[model samples]
Target: MSRFIAFFALVGLIGFALPRSAASQDWQLTDANTFAPANYLILTIPQDEPQALAALADTLAADFGVSLAAEWSLNALEVHCFVFDARNVSDVDGLITAMETDARIRTVQRLRSFSLTEMFHSDPLLPLQWALQSMRVLPIHASSLGEGVRVGIVDSAIDNHHPDLADQMVDLFDFVAADPVPLAEAHGTAVAGIIGAAATNEGIVGVAPSADMVGLRACWQQDGAPGVCNSFSLARAINFAILNDIDVLNLSIGGPEDPLLTELINVALEAGIVVVAASGEGQELVYPASLDGVIAAGQVAGRSVPAPMVDVLTTAPGSAHRYVSGSSIATAHVSGVVALMLSQDPTLTSAAISERLNGSISDVETLPMLNACTAILGPSEACAL
Candidate 1:
């Protein structure tokens, strides 16, 4: 019976989030100048000959007038080459035909733009949506959403026009360009909205609706391909957050562990700032989530076997109210809950807060999930899980 009910509930949630027509929106061409600056041209070459393929790649880069960024050997039969600034293909269709005709080339794919905002709007467990509903039923009410907290989001840039988050954005910094204005990336804006959207009538409110937000653009915006800023950019962002005396630093991005980043995380910890990071997809742990003093979070559905470990919901971008599931989204949940805890006691140190959160988690025997509020507030001695 539980299985039967769970199946239907999953279907119902999907239906609620996405209507038939809404799913068929046409893919639009990416504007290189708007948000992304360069398009990536990915070419797969025959892998049997490394030296020959490298020579071919150099020839192709010179012939196509594009910069060759990285090349990797994928087994003995394939080599992948990444080309940057490839927006101006003389003839895209012709180029594909030529590549298909080339004996050395195996496949060619163009990187396209993906709407991060639209992706979030389709989430089923929107964080802010859950928080508002929970506020009505829970005994604790946040005196004010983010009454005295400052959150720094190191991602893309926030949309200054987002109705719920616009006013709360206090500053912008572009680590890539060393400028005050952020490079336009919808990913950052969506993240910002999740962290601190206002309780305005236009859309769903953030968990910390009144919190001040600092937008730090640490990720690069490529024209046709997804761009990533390196570990240095991330390390710098963490330092900036610490220097500014930010109460919390939210980092939703992740990659392979770097020693430099590990060192910087330690510095942030010593400075008494709460650092929250998304645990990677599935159970795979990622930094800074895996780092000590950082809250690592996972996602859960409303009907999942166990209550979510930091399974706080949030509003999706744009007008549609969808719920998203990700460690990044979970980071927002922890950040909002931390804001509530700080509101109750401003003197709580970062280490103290981390200890309280880890100790307060409600143990679910069914699954590895922890209740966000219970975790933040600590377990009640009289209550049984």
Candidate 2:
């Protein structure tokens, strides 16, 4: 594994005292920017030949009139990644095609973004998260707080110091920058807040409050900045999750399909980790979720899509709470419930988890709404012999 990959592990950490980052989603700054990169592309070569990888990067840089920004090698998987300088909108597609024609290149992908909201919460808030009722998670919490289940979150920065997440976070690693210091936590804070915020009776509770969490940051952050994650960073995070024996992987971001990421998702599934993904708008699903062996979750109150999408309240970066509305939040709900099920039966495989979820689906119309009590309280389930 690369030194970058090696940085991720469960360890005792210091205090988080960074300034808070406020989120504002204006028209131009949609959440989709998190997964997609307009000017960047991720090139994966099958082998880890340093010279060959350097030559490829130089060739792409020279041909595209760009610079070689950085490179990383996944030694375990023998996958090499090269990140080139940004390009104009007119040049991105052509540059990607030019790189794809190389026989040495196994896959070339234009990094795209996925949508996930980060709203500041204030004023009169619901005493309890309204979405929990629809998800059917409240009842199951009586028996399972998702102990012993490790839920892995691959997204933007999370506030490791936030009271809601400080103690619950089992591990933290970054794929974008090797910063020895902790980076700003926004989207990641919100995502983790939903999945496993501590139930301290301070603010809105998380879905699997007691479940252990390992957060792998593939996206960077800035105040009012959209979520940012490229294929290379995301794959690196996924590889880390797989190597660390993560029980359930939560991918709350998705965009255009990339073969390299697809292969990694397949690898995680084959390793018996339950993978959860978010659904984008329209029938054409997003990557990973669109791929086989991933559970696609959409936020809907009923079978039919409502005019204004349902709003969900979850945890935020600071000690405060927030409301996020989208499929990403919905995906977190499913992941939390899945963790609850895993808490009851830690040996459940991806197939067994899916089977239980599928069998417990009370209504096909409400796609993302899950029957948590049934999924977790049912007979212990595992991969068939």
Q: What's model 1's TM-score?
A: 0.56
Q: Tell me how candidate 2 scores on lDDT.
A: 0.68
Candidate 1 lDDT over 1-385, as tens digits, reads: 1111111111010111112323332212233334232256567654434445557777887776765654444333434443434656677666666667777666776644331111122223333465433322122233346678888888866666656666878987777775465245655665676667765445655667677789877877566244476887887887798899788888877788889988888888888788888776665567667776677765433211122324344433343344455666666666766776777788888777766665554445444444444544444321224
Q: Which residue pairs does candidate 2 place in steric collision?
A: 32-114, 32-115, 34-227, 34-228, 35-112, 35-113, 36-112, 36-113, 37-111, 303-365
- Candidate 2 residue-wise lDDT, 1-385, digit = tens: 1111112222111211211121221111112223226676767666534455567677767767777554555445556555565654477777778778877678877654332211112213324576655555655665678888999999887888877788999889889887647765667888888898776545566788899999899987777686878999998999998899898899878788888889889999999888988776555567777777888776333321111125667666667676677777767877887888888877788778777776655543543345666676652211100
lDDT of 1 at 78: 33
Cα displacement (angstroms), candidate 2, residue 154, comes to 0.2
After TM-score superposition, the amount by which residue 122's alpha carbon in candidate 2 deviates from its true location, in angstroms, is: 20
What TM-score, over all chains together, does every model reach?
0.56, 0.61
Q: Candidate 1 — which residues are off by over 4 angstroms?
A: 1-128, 131-139, 142-144, 178-184, 221-227, 299-323, 363-370, 375-385
Model 2 misses residue 336 by how many Å? Answer: 0.7
